[model samples]
Target: MPERQAFRERIRLEAAERFAAGAADAEVAKDLRVSVRSVRRRRRAWHDAGTEGLRSAGPTSRPKLSEALFTVLEQELAKAPVPHEHDAVGDRADAARARFQSPGPGPPGDRARRGGRGGLGD
Candidate 1:
């Protein structure tokens, strides 16, 4: 991913340089192996923010749910029935109803129930 980002940044820099040299968007797109739309977008960014705009913005960080909220969600999910219990039914309606019923305990090999991190298990 980092390598891909670096390559993308290089392309953006090259596009910006070509644009600064008064190259057409189509030419820059073809030369950089990118879409003309990308070239136009890079040109707009360059015009709006100079060389800094040509640099990668880096990955965006998303906020995770708070532990309290996560716990609530886990509790809600825990109320759902186990998938294995419905497997033998062979009936679609029964299977659907079973899927919505509480599953009770975790299945074998469930890391969360085995005291591993990140699940409804305490």
Candidate 2:
């Protein structure tokens, strides 16, 4: 887990102090402008352990895409996608067109060819 911001860490520490002084969860939550659930959770941790339980565990995540790979992905996305040898690509394109194209003033034969209703209630 990434560490909470410094202010947030200070807030929890302050809550620990209030917990030590025997302040109620609602009172702490209202004073801190934090959720009552959060206050209750922190209170439980404070009761079980000291303020150390409220400390952040530092960052545990890494970027899914690195900087160099990200640039290549950005360039690829900037260009238009073209279908090549894959037969399914054409089917996908046709499905996308059907999904996006609103019914317009076209011929009944055209609608039938596109696998749609020729008119209302068809």
Candidate 3:
């Protein structure tokens, strides 16, 4: 993955350099074995934010949980084997489900049916 990213960055850098040297998009695309549209996009990004703009954006997702909560959850998950590891999968799954059930309010799907905010109900 790192090698692929490095190759992509190298391509962007070379494309930017060629475009700055007044190379046509079609020519740069052919030389780099990439599409002319990609070359043009890279050129626009370079013009807008220099080399930094050509760098990978990395992952777009942010964690759904807070860092502290995520850390606790990770630790908890690490302590237990997955349900499928048991000889009796169905029983193990049921036991695991019961162990993690929400103790708040009414029975399982009741709140969901009542138009409550979250959960698999919706």
After the best TM-score superposition of candidate 3, give how far the Cα of residue 2 lies from its true spot, in angstroms.
Answer: 1.3
As for model 2, its CA RMSD to the true structure in angstroms is 8.9
Candidate 1, which segments miss by more than 4 Å at Cα? 61-122
Per-prediction TM-score to the true structure, in the order listed:
0.49, 0.48, 0.47
Worst 10 residues of 1 by lDDT: 82-91
lDDT of 1 at 16: 79
What is the Cα-based lDDT of residue 97 in candidate 1? 91
Residue-level lDDT tens digits of model 2 in 5-26: 6778889999999999999999
Clashing pairs in 3: none
Tell me how far the alpha carbon of residue 87 in candidate 3 is from the true structure, in angstroms, after superposition: 25
| Cα lDDT, model 1, residue 9 | 90
Tens digits of per-residue lDDT for model 1, 1-122 = 58988999988888878888999999888888989998888899999998898898887764398779999999989897757654455678787898899977566668655677645564
Q: Model 3, range 1-122, lDDT digits (tens) per residue?
A: 46887899899998888978999999999999999899889999999999889988864676589989999999998896756554688888899999999887777787668886766666
Candidate ranking (TM-score, best to worst): 1, 2, 3
Write down the lDDT of every candidate, Cα atoms only.
0.83, 0.86, 0.87
Ranking by lDDT: 3, 2, 1
